[model samples]
Target: RDLHNRGGERFIYNLRAEPATPEFELHGKYYYAQLAPGTRMIWFVNLSRQNGFTGPVELKVEGLPEGVTATPVTIPSGLTRAAVILSAKTGAKIDARLVRLYGKAVYSDATGKPRDLVRYAHVTCELQVSGGSQARRPINTQIVGVTNPLDIVEFEATPSKITLRPGEKVEIKVRVKRNKEFTGPIQLAMPFLYGNSIIADQLPPGVTMSSDSKARLTGKTVEGTIVLEAATGDSAPKPLERFPIAVMGRISMSFSISTNYASNPIHLTILGADSKAAR
Candidate 1:
């Protein structure tokens, strides 16, 4: 006899038998089991009837392997049982297998042999495992516009043109915008030449460029001035004083204009030269 519960609180069966004697009654037992990685089974026997009236009764159960070990079992209040199969242990390697678990009971009568009382049930669990690696990846940049002081109106040099004997000296001032909004440093590159004849190459005597290397056009940009002294050669006393002196000659001046950015170079040139007498 096989019993099952599909929906309600009742046991449904497939086989029913009637015994002739009052001593020949049917008995049923329930069992529960778990499936993992080992081998196990269960068996049932009928001890209620002792004598007579017996024909050859064949019991065949499908869905079960042939090589299984059977043991008589019992279940508590609410539980089920099934056949469990397991794999042999191999060092560091994982073992994997499947098993079917269900509830089993025994049914027996005087005329018929003992049969399996089976019920279907379910099992719930979780699986887990562990180890593995991870990589790094790069970034890009761009540019914009330029601004100077308002007070620094224009750049002017004395004797707009200068002619040097050899060691003669000249002075120039770069006029700046007033009340400007510059807080960062400014770098000026002054290039001086003797009217395309010979490049002054060196700075003038007494007059020094901004010590800041990079001058700061801070506060109000009011007529910021840069004074430069030009010295002529020692031999040429008069030095023909009538050449040109240019400020910010073709050379480039570069520095950081802000706390966060760098300023593109502002190129200035001394176009002509002149001497003290010419001025």
Candidate 2:
């Protein structure tokens, strides 16, 4: 450069590192619903990653009105989507408003230091009136309210809890009580979703849902069994470990959409292979 400048010629060189951040975005068909008293609605959220982010994302709903509650859910690592279920109390009053849906995750930055990152859903959500099936109008805010009768009034799992040895297989009977208006077929399964490809079971490592159990309820049928088996070998969770599992009842809204309702959680305890059940 000095030689070139002396000869009336000029040149320049710039050096810098590529810029990046540990972050991601949340995407989904926003929580657009008018839940009624004694009803539930499920919101599905997918992740759009950036900067090579990889980890489970913890989800929360903010600005929900009184008498309405959201289930605690986490999008497992390597999975792209997770369901957020909102339930209204049997006596919830009429209310409506815009709400926020966001996700939080932890990742190590380029310096190897852990950092917390948060992101919100990119699109607006609309909370329509019950049975309001009309052409959608574009909007800019997320909405959810409590107002009309809906499906899946009550869903419960028998025994409430379970205890078993490694390699033991147990049966959990789930009963769905729905409003008189909804008598169509419903599918019951675990809550974990791997995009639209499959519905994965959310259980401890080595524990799995048995294929022999029935998962579909057609017509007047309201009860189904979910059998879980624990592996006897290395895959089983350690003795004394406990895991919480819920039965999810899904009603298809379309070929790609569904409304899911959850049952009361069941506490599952793993017993030692040669030992008696823990008290």
Candidate 3:
């Protein structure tokens, strides 16, 4: 629910935003690379947790130049999400700073008419901004243009949070996207560092611990799991602990490419002998 324009400003038109309703929600990316001549980019629009908004909903791209266009897509009822492609023709007006992007969702009510909703965040690129400069990385879908954007290696965890006391173990399901498209084995891991310094005596995540440390991503599969354990029979009181985690999806396309996906710093806390965890 935290929505803010990153590295740039979002534009607001005089259009009236629809009142917040319980029907459906729309989400898009914010950052994208500068478009070159004669090329296009693909991004996603996701609508989920639907209690209403049935029937077809039209998607539109706002704030682009004359030559650049977003292929408007309509999400049919009962479907959750779909992709929209944005392209700049070989002669499209191009400006790295002037051209910006966002998305809007519109749906009709029971009377079979069309209406408008507020402008919502539209997905652009998997981006990283350092020192006021920016870089765009490809994610989810493949990019096939001279824009030269890099691919993103990220993962989303099923049950993102886990809390267990000493002597307990839990399994966290990991699903990765944009891993190098190869047929080899993948290694998923977690950081076992204590405090700011790594436990250098044992390098590489999960290797210092029990069998729950590592896993393999099978053929064309995007799923894996993380098994965490608090050593048994050791009731010594310790501060809450956190770790950084990522998965290396092994593929045949290149050399030592770190197609690694990570998460926000995940922590473990022993609230008591029997407290439960929530996502």
Candidate 4:
């Protein structure tokens, strides 16, 4: 990871970390996640293999500040990336800290005996009381603090579930309940995008939001519609059961940074053109 100190000077600590033997390196981007109490963020992990090393790696995060927790990840052999979900509890303490990312695996030694090996990486985390503020820290450290809850407290999609056929179109209504502390406008969407680039999308392939959607929720406006259109013929997604999706409320902090809150997941089912539901 490339990191900068509080003074803005950029450097990497591992420039001289050359290993003399065949091994794998655990690494990931310097992630800056600012989360509030009761919110969560997804952190990504990466791996680099050297000297013909090919083994499954078990990954985990350590040194998380109080009130913040993360689930461990496992990168299978031949895979380069994995993700960990970090969540904060309600009434969590306001704090920040640097966390450690470690990976372990078993390899056969020259004597054909299984040997345990481990590697390390660093990540930064922060929990802030407000959004859109710049908080600086040393490399390989994370910050966790408490911020105000998002304007969207909770939301639900009407219909609760969906069953549609190929070439059919439907609309899902999202009703957002505000936090009362935040009265600003909020954009309700199904896909999370960063500056015209898709970051994470919740919709399944062949089922897309329509172009003419009015999904902006302003003051006193709590209801919005998301029109989903299924593809026709061969382009239609194959019959699938119980696809989970949710609505995301986005508040942009900058060109590349934003805070997103998600609603409950709803199930969607797609049927073939000539298929019929069982009685």
Candidate 5:
């Protein structure tokens, strides 16, 4: 059944399925995990890119060594990572084996129809004595896991929305909020780009965020602003549109610890040459 409610210029149409297939890519061919018997460990399956797939996903591990079991993981809608918990019995076998990983993307289609997409990965599972080191395997790459320090920092930008025309310029301020009772270092980062309905370090130029290649944390909290200039004359890429904003950076407590972190993207509405925002 379908529902089409007649409304002003913006009517509602309940789609039963998606117009096209949504895509989400999972990277990493193998994973390395080791833990003591009766103990548990956490790992992750990283995503190389998410192609407009805004839905929930489920992940599971299979073929682990005897006495070791994996608790399935489910990624909520709009998130790009999944964490799996591996637990070993007190008397579990101490051995090494190849295991299989699985992922299923679940979501609703445009027509409100339920749908699912699936993917598979391979992992080299190892069970060993607690605190013991095992020889690194060939496929043990991709340094993303559960214990990243950069994951805890917070970020925000001021004057989130701005209006600009050809040859116009503006200044936007960004701030990094840190956790209470703790002070270390935080940095801000984002590609120098303007498009895709989001503007970061482009437009007015004169960006003052120090290192755009790698935003290193300098203090427990940080704040800065950048100049953005709109294209002028005949080379303007956009006439009038609203774009969102996002910033990325790294956080580290010590020289040996660091991870990547990004701010929650926000929208920026632009009113210029031929924007349809007013309608």
Candidate 6:
């Protein structure tokens, strides 16, 4: 008997069955199942030997929550590969199954049924808040891009980020303190440009230097200011693009005396609109 049967009667009969035909046979199966939020999945099938399987196949997945959509699945011209992107909303978890249904065979059986395949992947993400309370709060964290924390470099200064209208001048003061003690004839040089041009040295028309003779080289003390004047133009000067300046030199030094000294760069800004309108 091709089929087996069980019975308690004296005489019993069994039914016969045959194996599935080649035309109705399924080739192979694969699946891309559970995925995390903002994740992707891919699927493919191999059909190199089958000559009649030359058409598109329908792909579908179920159990996905609301607000989630699946991408269209298509088989390439010469290759049997398909891809899809599965994006999930924030604070969402994805867990689902995929089902692939094969179309009717071109040659014989005309029997097409769906095959089940299971696959899974997971993802975890941390939220980042920008310019919010969490960002404003201080936390213990190490800096990544800096090498030297403490390195002595030359002194430099630039205009602050504050906005300056046309004809407006800003004053910036840079102070430099000497690390070692020395005494000699020093010359103080300041860059001619600060924010806006000096207008032929008119911004601070009155540039002067003052210091106490005792503090010159004897390590006593000295104080002074370098003043510049801005030129009066038909209209206020355009917004300052770049301002550069440097101060160097020793005015005087005493005999057998070493002193530590420092210099300050002072900048004064004039509002040409106010001054010009006033004039």
Model number with the top lDDT: 2
Angstrom error of the Cα, residue 268, model 6: value is: 62
Q: What TM-score would candidate 6 get against the native? A: 0.24
In every candidate, how many clashes are there? 50, 1, 8, 14, 16, 21
Residue-level lDDT of model 1, residues 64-94, one tens digit each, is: 3223222222231111111121111112122
Per-residue lDDT of candidate 4, residues 143-171 (tens digit)? 44446665555566777688778788888
- Ranking the candidates on lDDT from highest down gives 2, 4, 5, 3, 6, 1
List the RMSD of every prediction in angstroms.
46.9, 10.6, 14.8, 7.7, 16.9, 31.7
> Over the stretch 17-97, how does candidate 3's per-residue lDDT look in tens digits?
765553555554434433454444444456653546565555665556566666555555544554454556656554543
Error of 1 at 59 (Å): 99
Q: Candidate 5: deviation at residue 37, Å? A: 1.3
Candidate with the greatest TM-score versus the true structure: 2
**Better model by TM-score, 2 or 3?**
2
Looking at model 4, residue 254 earns an lDDT score of 60
- Estimated TM-score per prediction? 0.24, 0.61, 0.36, 0.54, 0.36, 0.24
Give lDDT for model 2: 0.71
